[model samples]
Target: MSFQGEQHPGVQAPTADSEGFRLNHTMLRIKDPEKALAFYTRVFGMRVLRRLDFEEMQFSLYFLARPEPGERIPEETGERTVWTFSQRGVLELTHNWGTEEQQDFAYHDGNAEPQGFGHICFSVPDLEAAQAWFDANNVTFVKRADQGKMKDVVFVKDADGYWIEVVQADRLGQMGD
Candidate 1:
């Protein structure tokens, strides 16, 4: 039997069903990428995997990741190092330069209420422990006394007034309960 760049019937190709879809990252507009990146690093322990600068457009791209301590990673040039790379879940930050008004920040009055986009959540292992960390850091929670439906999930506002939701990973399992 002769074959010419072909496979027999019922045979699957090497690339068939090889890889699955992975959530690369969630991109969000940030008034200040540096500030937001700092907050994420300080609060959530996320590290800056890489960053891109677009001088012509006056914008930047920052990719963050959560990696194990001293984790090694392959550089884009194929060089290996223990600096870690963006994997698992990533947070992409886009910073637009110049004097630009943030349409999202317009509707807010100190603790009056949470209007428009309420908050951005980050999953944590321990809810109480995470809440305590926020408290120790002097991060005020909006309507802390009255959490409403988000009682179990503690809310803390970053310097830019963006609410951060710290909820237990297991609690997320009870969502459909």
Candidate 2:
């Protein structure tokens, strides 16, 4: 588990205290709520667990997750909202109310000159099938797994121009059951 003998002088292994935590979610801002929702749900098969609209702040939040096969989303608003926060790997898309009307509206994808955020990632069960699906559907490709030096990683752009890294679990040496 060590860094293969390239360790820095002051580096040390992580302590056990980090074991209690898990990543809950990552947030991204979108120009149009409907478009963004459709892209995530239809393309990735994620579902909207809950949506919270902040009228006073002129914005709305949509929480989505790839639901388990037999897991049902709750019927009540309160219960559903709570359930939304309980899952890991949640994607929160925020829509500023009026951006849809602005013809030139675009959120900083963080890949331009003063680059900040790069991309988010998703693991697919089959790399070749996933790549073919993206191609047949005309999804924008920043880099195809076979074209780049990385050889087994795919990068596509979301509706908002945000890069999304698509990796196949099998390609990572973890074949699906």
Count residue pairs with overlapping backbones in model 2. 0
Per-prediction TM-score to the true structure, in the order listed: 0.65, 0.86
lDDT of 1: 0.67
Query: Which numbered prediction scores highest in TM-score against the true structure?
Result: 2
Residue-wise C-alpha lDDT for candidate 2, range 54-88, written one tens digit per residue: 99999889999998899888899999888888789
Q: In order, what is each prediction's RMSD in angstroms?
A: 9.7, 4.3
By lDDT, who's the top model here? 2
Candidate 2 residue-wise lDDT at 73: 84
Give each model's whole-structure lDDT: 0.67, 0.87
For residues 78-159, could you state the per-residue lDDT of candidate 1 as single tens digits? 2421232325567776777742465555324234554455566687877778877778777778645237775566778875
| Residue 177 lDDT (model 1) | 34
